[model samples]
Target: MSQISVVFHSGYGHTKKVAQSIAQGATAQLIEIDNDGEISEQDWETLNQSDAIIFGSPTYMGGPSWQFKKFTDATSKIWYNRGWQDKLFGGFSVSASLNGDKQVTLILLQTLASQHGGLWVSLGQLPSSSTAATRNDYNSLGGSVGVLVQVPSDADADAIPSGDLKTAEAYGKRMLDIVNRFKK
Candidate 1:
């Protein structure tokens, strides 16, 4: 079996819920960046030891939250040494708007993984875009790079759509499968 880790920062609890759903499906460890945009040294060890790492962050101001960015910046040491090279990587982003420029956040994550010479995993799920498709359907937001979750701005974290959570779970499963397939 391969070990996977989900490292993320949740500003308003919404992203944390999404990370939990993905972790459930991936059977992965969760490393949360605290409100101060810092994670423990143990969290860094977990990430370094993980066979696969999935990054999650809520999109704020059309990009990943500053907390997540701080975490990303802190990974420079690992990046410089190519510590994550050849590791499998995945990412997800959450936002309150249906088209909240979530793709930009995902690209930031993908690029970060690429910078460390890690393999990027695409969402790989076809979108639900038909006229009959509803918000409760998987990939209703039609994301291709990675998982995209949208919660209404007025709604609480608990009000996240079921479809988005399920999509996150499925993506977790996909990442696990890929990790196992490429395991040494």
Candidate 2:
């Protein structure tokens, strides 16, 4: 079986919901980056053992939260040893607005993954850009690098749109599929 890990930081709980949906679909484990911007030692081990790592964070000020960035910085130990080299990577992000500069956050993620010498898994699903597309549509955000979502600033985790969660699930499954196929 493919071992996938979603290691994320959720500031207001909204990103946690997105991460949960993705994990459910990918059968991936959740490794949370806590409020202090730290993950446990075991979580670090899990990350090293994972076949794929899906990075997640809530976009803040047009970028990943400083907590997630802190985690990224701590990866220097792994980066020096190329511990994650060739490991598959995917990313997802959520923000309060529709165009919350999600692309920049995703780009930062991809850059981080590349710095670790990891392979990236694209979203691989067609975007929902047609006029007929609804809020319930898949990939409505048209993020090819990974899943991206938007929730109102006032919305709670449970209030996240069903469509965005669905889109996350699809990306998770697709990621797992690719990992399984390439494992042999």
Candidate 3:
């Protein structure tokens, strides 16, 4: 099995819920970026040894949370050494609005992976965009670059749509499958 790690920063617990779903499907280790945006040296070691890495963060304002950005900035040393090079990389983001600029966050993650010379895995799932389609359907948000989720401002993390959670899990599995293929 491929060694996968999910590195994420969750504010208000919403992003953490999504990360859990993804980790559950990938059987990946979860590395949380704490409130200070600091991770232990062990987390860095785990990332260096993993076959795949998936990034997760909440979309605050128009992009990823400041904590996530801080964590990414701290990865400059790893980027210089190309520590994550050639690994399978994927990402997901959560926002409060359907069009809350979550794509910007995903793109930032993709760029981070690219900077480290890693290969990216797309969501590869079509949108559930039909009269018969509902929020409970998988990939209802129609994400191609990575998984995208929307949680209403008044809602708690538990209220995250089922389809979005399922999509996150499936994306995790997809990354694992791709890593297995590529590593072989």
Q: Tell me model 2's lDDT, rounded to 2 decimals.
A: 0.93
Q: lDDT winner among the candidates?
A: 1
The per-residue C-alpha lDDT of model 3 at residue 40 equals 97
For model 3, how does the per-residue alpha-carbon lDDT over 1-184 read when each residue is reduced to its tens digit? Answer: 6899999998889999999999988899999999999999999999999999999999998888999999999999989987888888999999999979999999999999999999899999999999999888999988899999999989999999999999999998888888888877
Every candidate's lDDT: 0.94, 0.93, 0.93
Positional deviation of 100 in candidate 1, in angstroms? 0.5
lDDT of 2 at 157: 83
Task: Show pairs that collide, candidate 2.
Answer: none
Worst 10 residues of 1 by lDDT: 152-161
TM-score of each: 0.98, 0.98, 0.98
Q: By descending lDDT, how would the candidates be arranged?
A: 1, 2, 3
> For candidate 3, what's the RMSD?
0.8
Error of 2 at 116 (Å): 0.5
Candidate with the larger lDDT of 1 and 2: 1
In model 3, what is the error at residue 157, expressed in angstroms? Answer: 1.1
**Position 23, candidate 1: lDDT:** 94
